[model samples]
Target chain A: MVKEQAHTVSSYEQELDQVRGMLVRMGGIVESQMAMAMAAIVDRDEDAAMEASERDPQVDELEREVETLSIRLLALRAPMAGDLREIVAAMKISGDLERIGDCAASIARRTLRLDAGDARLSPGGLRTMGRLVQENLRRAIDAMSQQDSERAVEVWQSDAAVDELYTAMFRELVTYMMEDPRTIRSCTHLLFIAKNLERIGDHATNIAERVYFAATGEQLPVVRPRGLPVV
Target chain B: MVKEQAHTVSSYEQELDQVRGMLVRMGGIVESQMAMAMAAIVDRDEDAAMEASERDPQVDELEREVETLSIRLLALRAPMAGDLREIVAAMKISGDLERIGDCAASIARRTLRLDAGDARLSPGGLRTMGRLVQENLRRAIDAMSQQDSERAVEVWQSDAAVDELYTAMFRELVTYMMEDPRTIRSCTHLLFIAKNLERIGDHATNIAERVYFAATGEQLPVVRPRGLPVV
Candidate 1:
């Protein structure tokens, strides 16, 4: 009887680990999606853009898998305390990661439209913003997989920088449109693309918060650092 | 023994009903947030914008309550099948509704910024778009509380219409910015506000999907209607 009880507990632990592994794997796919989207813009590679778009379905499929597994664990295992928090965090994090993929796909598609416009304008501060957001996403995913609350806090704090950079990009893009109305079509797409990247940063920070809460069993800080958005 | 079992089941049912009630209550707060946000734009009422912004904390508190109650249900009750699905959907729906509140607050904040600028351009088709979005939100909350899958499907189908209106507004706003450089500041804020409303419509549709799935143990249509996004 004791042996049977040991076997059941072991399997439950394995199931919990499996859920975490799936979330980490999903995060990796979403990271590549972000990388491909960024490459699409920096290199103006239409193939990269298409690749990023293609990755979206895969990310979404993984999210559903996480949802299914987490629900099954909830209904079957009846996790308690820390395990319960982690399982709940898995559901919320998967949702955020899925949104991050959507933002990547949206950015990638806009790049294709911008390429078709024949404007070929310089990206200016957009490159800086993209790199910062991409890095934040990486750190957030790292924090999740490593279960490092401190790293999650770091990622959460970096959102302010991304927001500030986005505001700067907004100003620069608007100036481009004002200087030459012919560039409005292209700059407009860039505006949304920049906004999409900023959104990705926000999602990453959301993931970071979930990670921190799940790992530490406490909320981050009362007052999150916020930047003055241009819009 | 049977008497005690009956009592336990009755209280568990009450817990499930409470989670659903919290979600519906949260939805009502979000709908008003959207309404006040629209009023801020239509009547240029700064106080309405402030009210919309203020309501966000209340909405958020309700969402956290839903989350706590749902998590407690999962950990304690270990709901099966339909009840489990409803609990999961409650958590997801509350997240969406909280985001809807965020979008409303963001829109309200931007209205203040728009008013700060001297350019008081006509709203064009934005008024129509806001009304449609508001109506959809109302329908979505009704579907949730009533467990009406058909109403949920209706809200899901209306997303394409909202998206189309948004694209039209995007073009109109760009024209205003192009025609008069002085209007760029105001129009840019308007652009983000329109996007925010479009997002509120999206959150409502997401809630609809959840409500439909929870009520009927089935996913919505695989191919969701999508519009050609201006970005």
Candidate 2:
């Protein structure tokens, strides 16, 4: 009976490891989607945007799979404490990653619209801001995959850089609108794109915080940069 | 043994009920805060904004309490299936509500930044958009409190109206900036306030969806309006 119980425990652990692997795979797709969306925007590549948009459903499918697997592990394995937290955290991190995919797809859609000349206004600072936010998201996922709380702490710390970029981006966009009437349409789309990237960054920070909680069982301080208000 | 088990089951039910009550209460405060923030914006009343900002900590404290109670219930009850979903939904819904409170506080801060001179800019559909979004949020909480999936569906249906109003408001604000450069800063703040309220509406919709899932074990369509890009 003891040997049987040990075998059952080993099987549960294997299931958990499989779920973790799926999460990492989903994270990779999400990261690629963001990068492709960025490229689509910067290069005004509609085909790339369409490809990113099409790939969103695949990410969605993976998210659903991860959720089902996590719940099954909970019900079947009855994992305790740390194991339970890991499963639950996996569920939440997948959720955040799924939303990140949504943001990337949304950015792709905006890129398509911009390419169609719905808005051609280019307010400065957005490309840099997008790059910064995308990097933060990528690092946050890496931190999760590595189970490195220290790397997660760095992601948490880097949230301020994203916010700083967003604030400066906002200021620049508003200034452009104030100065050039013709730039309003394009600038508005750019603003929405910037906002989407910033929200993606926020979700990444949320995942990092969850990682810290999963590792240490304590919530970390979520510090916003100076001058920007937390929403 | 049966009698002791009955007593323990009743105690668990009571605890669950208590947590649900606190969540409803927190939702109420957040809804009220959203309304008051809009009122402050429309009336340009700094005092109302200040009051909304101050009430945030109360909501935060309630959230912390709910989190503790939820974790305790999960540990003690080891609830399965529908019961577990309800508890988990409550935790997630409370989190979204807490974020709504934070957004309201953010709107209040933006209001505080706008001096008497800043209030001279034409708000241009912001008041109507704010009202629509706040109504959606209120109905969402009401649906959760009553466990009415039909009402939750209604809340989901109204998301398009909020989005429509947001689009109209965005267009009006852009037109204002085009007509007059002096309105840029005030209008930018107004834009932030509107965007925050719109996001709160989205979070409220998220909670309503969770409530629907908890009660019916089904995922519902997130019906966004047609003609708007799905950002």
Highest DockQ among the candidates is held by which one?
Answer: 1
Judging by TM-score against the true structure, name the best candidate: 1
Individual DockQ of the candidates?
A: 0.57, 0.44
DockQ of 1: 0.57
The model with the greatest lDDT is 1
Which portions of model 1 show Cα errors greater than 4 Å? A115-122, A229-231, B1-7, B115-122, B229-231
TM-score of predicted structure 2: 0.90
lDDT of each model, Cα atoms only? 0.86, 0.79
Tens-digit lDDT track for model 2 on B73-155?
Answer: 76667778877778777877887888899899889888877647767565547777787778888889888988889998888
Task: Find the number of clashing residue pairs for candidate 1.
Answer: 0
Model 2 per-residue lDDT tens digits across residues A1-231 = 999999998999899999899899988998888988888878787888888888887887887677667767766776777776677678778878888998889888877655255344452366787888888888898889878799888888888788877877777877877687666666666777887888899889988987887887776753444336544
Identify the CAPRI category of the predicted complex in candidate 1: medium
